[model samples]
Target: MSICSYLWCLIISLSCVAPLSGNPAAVKEQISLKREKTITNIVNGVPTIDKKFFARINMPYRDKVCGGVVIDRWWVLTAARCVDHVSDHQYELRNVFIEIGNFTTGSQQKKTYKAKAIVIHPMYNLTTNSHDIALIKLVKRAPMFRVAELCSEPVEYGTEVGACGLGSTPARHPSPSASLHEIFLRGIFFSFASFFEIDFCPDDQVCTEPITDGASICNLDEGSPLYKLQCHSRAAECILGIASHFVASEHSEINCSGGSNFASVPHPYEWISETIVFDFLFNSGHLDRSF
Candidate 1:
């Protein structure tokens, strides 16, 4: 997760204030979908559709719902934005429960895990989405869920990128239940994403769009992993970016039209792979004394 740089965060927090729901394309269109195995390989370079590539991170807040990528028995990747409020945490990764291996809301395929320690990027700035990545070291390793492999570069300009989450579609009024109704997401071709002037994707992130009219992100799906299609690779998943942004206007009109353009700050996993955090875990004996 990119740390919020003081300047970036301030600007983003202000972007939502002006609000842009008036644009018809920014609105969301609702369609009733029954649980169908998410169709993958529907777009180029994406892996097969046999299994879902995401996991749901349940949190206390309605809009701030977090997401996790199934890495292995002991790890999941999410955004530091989910826990940006932790100024005084010493592994204080709270409200970090993830339900993985499911297709629809309340799927039985879900497995719950507790974050043993959430290591937020040192440079993460919640305000600007700098280093907007985080790792939820699970108390117990997750099973069956395959960890999506991340791409090093911004997927080819017009690539088919996919996002999934037990996240919600916009609801102007809040639902009394905690369950988030997942949105029907597909491989969006980012062919024309500049009209909105939407800009949250930093060099560290990428989900702005050459696809999905207006090119936006969704509520609660924050911290969800982004993947590009890589059919030739045998890897179980093709992860391209991490979800991070705050641009949906929340205006009922936009939410109704079923269009919202947003972006996510991504962590070049190539960079993250060599960080001390990996070494800290390889030597598990250090957390108690290393810091």
Candidate 2:
């Protein structure tokens, strides 16, 4: 990708707030202080996702900033941008870990796993935000965490969906929430998005706006999952989209006050299935490869 393309990619990050400073020490200190203050406010009192199906993506150099959902005992699906770093080559992120079975960011009891490998969609383009999905392999299986089932059903316009993440709340804070926070968003059609001057990517992407006021995904975990509850059972949730970019409204450049786009997991169902299956077979010694 050209420098211009790369710059466009940065816009897709959790860029609702100012970008992190160059000094690693300063960034780390800021994260620590932010964690200390998170308990005082829970980001609009949004409840955290259940401990069983949620995961927090943390960097060794930075605090937890991204979110992911468990796909199986060994795999997680998140936005490619969350773990993407300019300094690293594709399919590799340094010192990335995920915390599972932990609801609070300050908790000491979460099961953390070092990432074994990372894979981004082969067709993912930074310029157009196409195929913005990524898969992560953990060094060990997290059998205790509940797996999220993939859904292939097409999403209709105006469907109510739920999104959760460790992202910060709008209007009140720039730091991420200490605990997971969730909000309900009603899906919107891509065509309608243009009328409101919102960025809507319908090709392999889904868009949503907050159902409540003063709620925007602004700086939430980049790879948080968007869920569609099963029609018959409230207990079951089908993974629909992986959070990618939050578009700022024309009036404000600092917040995703208008809407956000997620890479549609179901839209590229074949890619997701093939990627997961290939990894599974290779790891189990059923497939041979020369690398």
Candidate 3:
């Protein structure tokens, strides 16, 4: 017999015998193990390692009251409502602090920075929750922390996204979670904003539904960054939006079960870039005070 023909016959014989020789229960167990390993990487209200771009916004006597993402060395992007103080006139600049590089709320290794300024969107409306975005200028540049890149592309319906924050969970009511938690959510078409008693523009907001039951962004999760993995790698996160508010549902008693909306990063991309440049110039005394 030829060498090629002999090898082909041997391969066919092994293929036929391998399945017969394999134990059914063992094969099933191996398949189950493989599935479990794959599911482990998918976020489902699980604790996450410390992310350099994740920012915890803390108020006086409160830890991680809101969440933010570092967009620049001295700037953090967040929801306008998180630091809104229209009546108080910039009170958050003094009271709010930014904590970075910490997974837990009270970690000693966390770096805290005082806020130099809190800039809310000019068109932000308290009644309708429109233009719900803001920026926080840090007192000094955040060192050793990576800046999250803002995503310009629109999130297509059914696309998977990730959200991370130190927010309230079922076990921790009336208080934020002690450690950072991440959950996977899918972009959805949410047209019934009025029915849910939430206001959002489809063009400027990204609506999402949780992939895992009982896993959602809850209280104190406002301003938490909604990101997508770049190149399917956990290390490369592209910020898509910031958590704005939860859509209340009359059918469900659970918080954030109905779904949530985020202020799209690309919607305010121009404003953000301009504001940063203007702030830098003004603070550096390059711009005329009279002008």
Candidate 4:
């Protein structure tokens, strides 16, 4: 196969951390603390390794919260709710930065980009959380970063997909994790017969439960990618959905374990394609001057 074809095939396959040195006593004490297992917010997830291409969406003040996947050299795919901070349904892209390559927040191995523009789906509805996908354009091309390929194949029930993010644990993470974490989720059937069900896992979404009984996405995990491993390639994975919201038992509580709803990429591939094309053209109009 040609280089371009191989690369595109890889694209269709969409697809951490740290410590210090010191005095003997102090070092032993630090190692002891590190070995101690704290309650994780993601339930049963584990930390991801290096070289994976994921996006950590942070606010102007460097507060990393939401998660995203790089889809192009200059564009990232994330949940619309992550960047839609305004309440009046207006387009107000916030001053946010995209952190790439660094699993841990402050690591020098990562690349940072100032978001040049935010594009939320025009038909997104906050009341019901429908059409929940969005794209962010970086100020410049991320040639060194790996980009995920957009996949339109339907996800089958019972397919196990992997999700990664910097979300905190239920006790409320003191701050975002230094490393990106991952969890395996299995596809499930969602019945939209009732109004309540429709409100949570609407027609346009896909429902998934953690492969482990207690695994779940916490407060800061919104917009993370839901992807499947490539059929024969360990290094390649395909993007199937974008984490939008979750559904837990009715209770006045935080960090409850439950299933999550993802904005189905296959269902709205056209919209995504059109939006990306329009944004690229709009932004690239001045490229020739620089070229």
Clashing pairs in 3: none
Error of 1 at 114 (Å): 1.1
Deviating ranges (above 4 Å) for candidate 4: 1-41, 61-64, 86-94, 104-106, 169-175, 189-200, 232-236, 249-253, 282-291
Top candidate when judged by lDDT against the true structure? 3
Write the candidate numbers in order of decreasing lDDT: 3, 2, 4, 1
lDDT, candidate 1, 53-127, per-residue tens = 476676554344566676545667777777656433444455556776655434476667765665676667766
> How high is each candidate's TM-score?
0.60, 0.73, 0.73, 0.71
Please write out the lDDT profile of model 2 over residues 76-136, one tens digit for every residue: 8888776655223323344788888867657666788877777778777766777888777
lDDT of 3 by residue, 1-291 (tens): 999999988775444221222354553333233221110011237777746788888887434378899999989999888777523334545678888886755567778888877778887775666778988888889874568888876644456778888765552253567888888776643333323333334567777665676566766788889886543354435888888876543333443444567788877888888888887767752222112
The Cα local distance difference test for each model comes to 0.46, 0.64, 0.67, 0.64
Q: What does the lDDT read for residue 250 in candidate 1? A: 35
Total backbone collisions for each predicted model: 48, 1, 0, 5
Candidate 2 error regions (>4 Å):
1-45, 49-51, 62-64, 86-94, 189-199, 231-236, 251-253, 284-291
